[model samples]
Target: MAGGTDAGAGAAAEVPGLVGVPLLGSLFDLKSDSLGTYLRAQHRHGDLVRVTAGPPGMRAELYCVFSPEGAQQVLASEAANFRKDNAFYQEVRDSFGNGLLTSQDEDYLRQRRLVQPLFTRRRVDGYAGAVAAETASVIAAWDKAPDGVVDVSDEMTHLALRAVARILFGTDVEATAEAVARCFPVITDYVLRRGYSPANIPRHWPTPGNRRAAAAMDELYGVCDKIIAERRGAGAHTAGRGTAAQDGPVQDDPAQDSAVPGGAGEDLLTLLAAARSSDDGEFDASELRDQVLIFLLAGHETTATSLCFALHLLARHPEEQDRAREEISRVLGDRTPEAADMDRLPYLTRVLKEAMRLYPAAPVIGRKAVADTRIGEHTVPAGADVILAPWVTHRHPAHWPDPDRFDPERFTPEAEAARPRYAWFPFGGGPRACIGQHFSMLESVVALAMILRAYEFEAVDTEIPVGAGITLRTDGPVRCRARRVDG
Candidate 1:
């Protein structure tokens, strides 16, 4: 961060870029094919490329750092120079308010401190049976599917939502989960279009897009309110009992709190609902609502898509699918998976990592430059948006040999050790990385193992159509059938 601008200042101006038709620059190209555009530019322009786009006369800049060196510069080494901005931040904040993902500085730090305890190994290990039980129940419902043709995307979505609802909030808001399922795609689509496009449309404009987004938010907020009210009704002191006031940290054997509506265990919402600050002010209702809403979406949607993509990839590659199923069977031997079994199922972890490489849960990591910084030979100006794309970086031929091929061995300890850390960040790097990474990984491993153990899925169609929204997801239903293989 200390390097003078004189070093790479001129190089920044000379950095190679994509030629555009007009003020829209690469905006149109992004609309047609975003992944293709980024990869193509990374190939032609090397690691540092400046992307600019806007309406006819306006030009907005979005700098892309593709190489691991550049990624390190922004994410780890010089992270202080780059901070979350109002660009994408404003839009995300509008949705979840001041939750963990969108907050910065002291406010973010405080919220992070409060939420981090809820995801520590001690807390997360207690949610495995909840995840496994939900997985079993889902498979049972699949047993009722007439021909066993199931939508893996929808199925995974419900599984993740139920898990988050039951484990995180300690309640099952089924109707809200259903509402998010119905309304989220539209909301994600709207967010992406407005976030990237040169069009500066105000939310209060009441355009068709605005109206649809508003309606969806109403449905989502209605659910959030209900969840908050219920948790608050349980008495804050009761919810806060076992959470924040831990007697230091302690390890334990595998166990899950049967934290359902009628269960005796404490939930995240209940914990926060009961929490009070040093000054004796109780946790604000809005903060609880904001954080819970974030956990619901993040804990549910991203993990669901990751599982869906992993299943899709496994089905496409029979060798990998069989290998994964075999590992699950050998490890559990007809018994359901417990959190402890995760260590024994290395292949499943590799498959999940490989799938994440091909289809990262969060595709693009965006940050704003708080100060001028030198990324390799290019000196990026302050106020610019720095974009680190896992989708592009993971597949870049330089870092990954035969990057397009689906091979889980790429995640072997030896292989991972040989590469740069930023080369494989499904969860964003640095201090602001995802708080739910552990919970997500555990849930995916358990759920993927459970699904493959009881049933094998076959691709209805070999072709995959990908989409980019709040999360990178399959464009349509991932149609596959569940064939029972267990006695």
Candidate 2:
């Protein structure tokens, strides 16, 4: 087994001079929102500190080994030793089934490979027009009521949901959007509650929240099933028929049989229907349905949360926001940005990066050690839960100077090069890093550019409450006043 430091060779090096109560060690302080208390303990106790929670064997620990060397050791050098912990995965599994985020080992790898291509730059870029169109529509709607206070969070949620729906299902997303939206609050609320209490109860004897969550999940899945059925039928209709390669019906093309290699690119449903296993195995309809549901559920909400935070930050920091808007105007005068234009929007990119750094959509990523391993100088037990928190690490003063300040300059190419590789992990790290990262980034940039070009946003309130569950978000509604930019 590996170890961080050898204070005295054979013993689990007790943190130097740090004291804790018999039970309920640091839980009270932690729950009371004392980040400094925990951070101070880390500073005083060295790299690793262990403290008992509410009960014996209910221990909580903190590890400050988040440097590039430590991140490489945990994420790459000894990755096999880590797996999703039961406590964390249980909550995600209960809500999302064994989707990419919750699945582990072989299953996770397989699903990831299959889904990876969908998030490639080419594929993601393909949706640029859809993103721009949807964002424009939302902005237009907002323009209708300039004087009224707008709940920007709600606006972002709807906009992101619509954009993702178009990308995944193609055309007329109204019904599906309604179904998914109906279930979102329930899923979000349940996930948040489970974080505080990591126990399981029978679904049949559900609490009111659980019952609603379960029902919402069922309803959402029902919508996915219907979409899959429709696509499957379409696939069947096109399977045997010889269709034209381009600009004509399948039956009309000269080389119809060989024209379109594999699946059609018309929509996500078509892609999934045509997607075949590398081993020539066919995807069952249910698997396709589950995957579609996973994409919609996971993709939209996370992006929405991040965008909401980004808007709030921009409104608060007007100079940064102005810089971003100026860059957008310079790059794209009156034209909507195409995929190629993303490369030119440096300030907008920085704004998005800084926003995500402050409030990562998925704040913490955790894994359970499968075998004894040394992370830095600490000897992690085989079953110990290891957590790498972007929320915490992204703001670590050692890694980032004046980390709390909303500074987009930190993301400049020169500034970025100066930092450690793993110092800013807004989308996580290693082989399990988000496949849709580029896609999400592209979408965010485009959406922000469109909004900025159309409106000048001002903070309606100075004080905004923040909270975190699956994603960091404003506790109450975030209202902003948007004045249309002068022509």
Q: Which of the numbered candidates is closest to the native, going by highest TM-score?
A: 1
The per-residue C-alpha lDDT of model 2 at residue 277 equals 52
The prediction achieving the highest lDDT against the true structure is 1
TM-score of every candidate: 0.92, 0.87
Worst 10 residues of 2 by lDDT: 243-252
Q: Would you give me the overall lDDT of model 1?
A: 0.77
lDDT tens digits by residue: candidate 2, 1-487: 2544334434555333246566666666655543444456555664444433455565555343444555655676677777776575677677767767777777776666555544445556767888888899999988677585577889999999998888777764887888878887788677666755535576668788767888988998788888778877766325432221122111222332332322244566666565545443444776776677677767887788778878888999888888888899999999989888878988889889998888778765667767766555556666666656566667767778888899988999999998878788777678777767887887898899999898888888657666556666566888888888999
How well is each residue in 336-387 modelled by candidate 1, as lDDT tens digits? 7877887899999999999999999787778998778877667778888888
Reference-based lDDT, residue 46, model 1: 83
TM-score of 1: 0.92
